[model samples]
Target: MSQVRPGARRVLGATAVESPVIQPRLRTIPEATVARLAVYLRVLAGFADGGRTTVSSGELASAAGVNPAGLRKDLSHLGSCGVRGVGYDVRALRERIARVLGAEQSRACVLVGLGNLGTALADYAGFGSRGFRFTGLFDAAPDRVGQRIGGLPVQPMTELEATVTGTGVSIGVIATPAEVAQQICDRLTAAGVRSILNFAPMTLTAPAGVDVRQVDLSVELQVLAFLGQQRAVPAGEVPA
Candidate 1:
């Protein structure tokens, strides 16, 4: 019998050397840290586009509109750090964030309503890159019942439960009008959707155990108006 090398294998049933096994490290980063990671990634993308190789924490924070200390803490959670004098590697950090966020994998999502914003979101390509797959489209409109948006066929509101059950869709995106926002949310909850990203301009009242994230355009505009008013006022002026 021939002796195999320490790191080599022999043919057939001959002796084979074992290779070093690498232990997988377990990491549990905070949810807040994970959220900031995306902002850092976008900042890194801008740097990459400008041919930048390194970015200081301060620079990244400024670019991403975050605090320097907060950005440093978030990056540190991933076991990544900038050298004493040098900054972080823009490309490497972006790839690391993408991996941690599971951006490469495809996640299925269901969209309710076929209004303008809903149609636009269905047509948006950014969701695909971020592991979001728009698999089902539902609407109350009779005409939109049989329509197709972004290659996904639209189904009537009545079929919402069946489609969600069949496809195992958990993430729901509600884009219905303000009047029917709560009603639609209840139906989505009934269909076993746990998480919802609502675009309707109203607060949704769902049962316990259901997560509803509201994205009200009108409320956003109000916030913008408040900020604009602050800017319009003098630096030392007080608002009534």
Candidate 2:
């Protein structure tokens, strides 16, 4: 008698048996859809907190600041279809969206640089409530080091690698000056951080598999100024 392994065809005398081949398809969700899902989840949470059990597409769309059809289309990605004359179950929808967004798991985050912007982010109370826990804060300045901000003592940048490894931080925030932003990013990536939130004026580049999001307040303000100037200009007037 010949022994048969799982998924391998077994031969007995003149007969052979084969296992069925199963191929799984990977589902790819659009980045824009994922962002809108977060907004929808928040709106759903508010509804649930208000003792609402169900929400119509139009109502949810209005609350989420999107069109009803577009909201329905987004929800379709989750394979959720509302019943006739009834809307989605608020609590269920919220839980589904949260699961898809990985909001159920808390991620450790480390902050580098203790400048004004960094300090403001450290003091923000929304991080904890939104599944982000600050595990470490670092600064290059000797004076800033050893000082406490937002209940966490600021460590020297020299301790960044150790702190990140010890805390299992997956996300790093760079608030350093433009000159040192890339250096800090490299350090963070080398320390095993794959996601970064950058507030520095200069753009920071990361190696493959690392995600970096930059928030430039100056650029945002300049965009607003440009729009203001456009509005100020008359239909036929050309500014020299």
Candidate 3:
């Protein structure tokens, strides 16, 4: 008798028999839903911290700036069937969302470029509660090296690889100038950083399996300005 491959159907003469070890279907969550899940997590966290025990979907949706129906659909992806009248349990829902976003596990992060924006981001208080902790800081400037910010001393670029490797860091933050951003990104990727949050104004390329998220302040400001104009001036009308 021929051996049957796991998760595959095997032909036995005219009868097809499925292998005993069946492969489970991959439950792919939509990219948009993933983004919204972060928003929901943030809102749920706030609710939990505020001592709220239960929240209606409408309340959570309003707080998250999403429609109630859409919010329910997003929560459905988590396999949580919320009660019809009572809505969701605040702490329970928060924990569920956090697990899905991997927020329960502490992720060590390394940030390069200790300029103004970089320094401020390093000092941000919100990261700790969200399961992210910056274990290392790197800068190319000699003056920045050995300087301490947010309880971590800044290291020269030479220390990046060693520090990342030592800390088991998989996430990196780049706040360098546009010209040097790609160089720093390349170094981080080479050092085993798989996910990057880029604050530099330019785009940085990475090899397959690496994820890069860009934060362009000017673009966001311009978009907000455009929306503000739309409120002041009716559609299709230009301001004099």
Candidate 4:
């Protein structure tokens, strides 16, 4: 006589379900590596477009403004190693890096200001080539609202939520003045945007899991001026 197994008994004459397979979690890549991967991808794209099939680490690093060893180490995180005698396959490496960086997918982004800087960002063609599509443009000014930029209508602040939800936008850009940048950032975060590119001069605070990057042209200029001043100072001479 055959014996029935425990916990394997039939329920309503149906056999017991098998357990689902457990998959291993993916390793977390360093943020620096991620940034370099984007650089590498861009360089590889240029090579591929120019009909180049392979790239040595030294050549790629030089183009990417990074050291060869560091570039190789970063690529190694993605399990890519160049052949012993040959360099990396440009097309293959580009595809791999694109996958790693999620650049293979187009992400919808919304710009929240239509001022001079905002207008320039909206009109930029590079974002599209890099897989970021602008789905909405917004401005608080009445005169700016209803105007069109880069074929996208300048929407009012009132329509921000609707635009974000309707277009499934995940990234937000805040190019408004410092006074209103925080307000815009709050609205964007509440509307389900997780990544923000802030062009305003002030820093923004967001809850955990949200990413905010600030780009201040004035600050950059100030940094350059400081460097210039250092270079101009005579060696071993103290300035009053």
Candidate 5:
């Protein structure tokens, strides 16, 4: 049985296609552990690309920024066992983790709003290596439409639904402004986009079962500013 949201199913060309859903293990795995597992996958891919075949638990944990015990615990959720001395087979472990994270197959995505940030995101080529492909680019402005970025011509927002439905685009990346972000989000959900990566500065409301992840650049910068301020505190600053 597919765990993917049914709304993500779409008719692409002459065939009805669906995104490769995460395996059943997702339901049993803790969300925090799942996140760490993805980090571990990236670390393993780096090792594999460098021609490494095997990895010790300590080395893998260090590269992934986790302790050995915690790394073992996370993999344990996947029923993956590390050899007593040999640690784990790098290639095998990566495959196991990718299966659970839904990274084994490329997921189609569409981007709305082709301003500076949106244009930059569309032009990034690194998404292909990580199992994501942007199949459609869109903007509400007429001037932006017909302009090409990253090899795909920007289309008008009027074409958003047909494109998403035809491409089986399961995820949407919204980089529009605050005032119109919710409207864009609503349109994406209505088009059968099950997950969204919102770079807009404001929050968005969506129908039930739609997953929305908000990435606010200014707020993140503010958090880092707070941390930097704390680091600059003088000694003997224990006063309340």
Candidate 6:
């Protein structure tokens, strides 16, 4: 079969064609490892665009900001054995990682909160352009509710439970204020949401089996400040 270049096809290692769903035989690979596979896939695609046909484990690690040994170990779980001296086939590895990450299949997402950030996220072209489709947007404010943002209807928060339950929304983007984030999270969890991409600046407690990933603007700014301060310090000024 002729494979379409730049399409959603996966190439595992040198010759294996794999699907995104984890098979019973490959259940040993951790979910964290699976997440990183997508990161690696994006890096490899960059290399492929640069005319590189092959990449070593060390090279892939450097590009993806991971250790070579760890990268190799993760790839090994996918049955990707790097050639002893030839390294890995870049195209093959890229496809395999995409397959494992389900890049070919789009996942639906719901966004809650119609604040500035939420509005921007609702309008974000990256999500839909990628494999994440946003089918619902919600907010608690009556004035904002029933409005349309980013081509998605901003429904009232009262409908969150039903919309999520009916849509089988596995992923949620929480853009609500810190005060209401946990409450929203609880509702989402109770409504069967399993994964959350949290932009609220508060710690949310969820029961087992729920995955919550936080994106804190202040935290990122602080890290950037730390890096800037480190650069300003003298190399040998440790006399404190």
Task: Work out candidate 5's RMSD over C-alphas.
Answer: 8.2
lDDT of 3 by residue, 1-240 (tens): 011111123221213243546823225566677778888888887898899999999999999888999999888877865887788998888888888888999999999999999999899988877899999999989999999999999998998999999999989999999999999999999999999989898877899988787778787777778878888776665648
Query: What is the clash count of model 3?
Result: 0
TM-score of 2: 0.83
Residue pairs clashing in model 4 are none
lDDT of 3 at 220: 70
Q: Tell me how far candidate 6 lies from the true structure as C-alpha RMSD in angstroms.
A: 9.0
Model 2, residue 143: C-alpha shift (Å)? 2.5
TM-score, per-candidate, Cα-based: 0.75, 0.83, 0.85, 0.85, 0.83, 0.73
Judged by lDDT against the true structure, how good is candidate 3? 0.84
What RMSD does each model have against the real structure?
Answer: 14.6, 12.7, 10.5, 13.9, 8.2, 9.0
lDDT of 5 by residue, 108-186 (tens): 9999999999999998876877789999999989989999999999999989999999999999999998899999999
How do the residues 1-240 of candidate 4 rate in per-residue lDDT, one tens digit apiece? 001111122222113343445523235566667767888888888999899999999999999888999999889877855786899988888888888778889999999888899999999998998889999999999999989899999989999999998999989999998999999999999999999988888889998988777677776667678778888884746648
Candidate 3: give the clashing pairs: none
State which candidate has the highest TM-score. Answer: 4
lDDT values for all models? 0.78, 0.81, 0.84, 0.83, 0.83, 0.80
- Model 1 misplacement above 4 A: 1-33, 49-54, 81-84, 231-240
Candidate ranking under TM-score, highest first, comes to 4, 3, 5, 2, 1, 6
lDDT of 6 by residue, 1-240 (tens): 011111233332323344557543444566556667877877887899899988898898998888899888889887855688899988887777777666767887899998999999988886774578887899888999878887778898888888888887889999999999999999999999999888898888899988787777777667678778789894856578
List candidate 6 stretches off by more than 4 Å. Answer: 1-35, 48-53, 65-70, 81-87, 230-240
lDDT string, candidate 2, 26-106, tens digits: 245566677688888778878988999999999999998889999898888767557768989887888788877788789
